[model samples]
Target: MGREFSHIARRCERAVVTAYRELRDGGRGDLQAFGACTTLYRIHHPEASMTEARRLVAEWIDHHVVRGASSPTDGCDCA
Candidate 1:
C-alpha cells in the first residue's frame, strides 16, 4: 500500500514538473492543468490525502512568482 501511494505521489510530482516545463517554454500557465492532475488523484483514490497536492501547488507558485524564475522564453537569463 505504501508503494502504491508512493507511486501516486511520484506521478503527481511528474505532472508538476511537466506543467512547469510547459510554462517555462512559453506555454499557458493556467491552473487547470495542475488542478486536473490533482483532481485525478482525488477521484481515483478517495483514501489518499491531499497534503502532497497542496504542497506541490504551493511550491509551484513560489517557484514561478516569489523566486522570479520567468518562463524560459521570457527573455530573462537569471535562473
Candidate 2:
C-alpha cells in the first residue's frame, strides 16, 4: 500500500510541476501562477480547500526558489 501511495504522490507532484510550467510559460506573475496551480491541485484533490491548496503551492515554490538561489552557480562570476 505504501508503494502505491508513493506512486500516487509522484504523479500528483508531476501534475503540479506541469501546471507551474504552463503558467510560467504563459507569463503569469507569481501570485497568479500560484493561484492557477492551486486550482489544478484542487482538481486532483477535491477535498482540499483553496487556502490549503495555496499554502501547499506557496511552500513548494518557496522551497525550490530558496534551493535555486543558494546554488553555487546562482551568482558566480565564472567565465
Candidate 3:
C-alpha cells in the first residue's frame, strides 16, 4: 500500500488517507480510526460542522481504501 496514496492531489485528502490507513494497520478498529480521522479533518478545518467532517471522512475512506479508487475526490477548498 506504499504507493496507494502517492497520487492524491489534496493535502487534506492525503493526510486523512495516510492517517486512516496507519491507524487501521496499527490495530485500531474501524470506528476508532474513523473518529480519529474526523478529528484530524477538523484540526485542519475547524469551521467544518461535525456532519460535514464525518461525511467527508467516510467518503474519502470509501473512495480510496474500500473502493481502491484513484479518481479525484471532492471536499473542502484545501486543495
Query: Which candidate achieves the best lDDT against the true structure?
Result: 3
lDDT values of the candidates?
A: 0.46, 0.56, 0.90
What is the C-alpha lDDT profile of model 1 across 1-79, one tens digit per residue? 0111122224444354455445645655556655654565455445556875555455644554446444322211122
lDDT per residue as tens, model 3, 1-79:
3347778888888999999999999999999999999999999899999999999999999999998888888767877
Q: Where does candidate 2 stray beyond 4 Å?
A: 1-9, 69-79
lDDT of 2: 0.56
For model 1 the local lDDT of residue 27 reads 57
Candidate 1 Cα deviation (angstroms), residue 2: 32
TM-score of model 2 vs. true structure: 0.61
Which pairs clash in model 1?
none
What ranges in model 3 sit over 4 Å off? 1-3
- Pairs clashing within candidate 3: none
Question: Which of candidates 1 and 3 is the stronger one according to TM-score?
Answer: 3
What lDDT is reached at residue 29 by model 2? 83
User: Candidate 2: lDDT of 6?
Assistant: 22
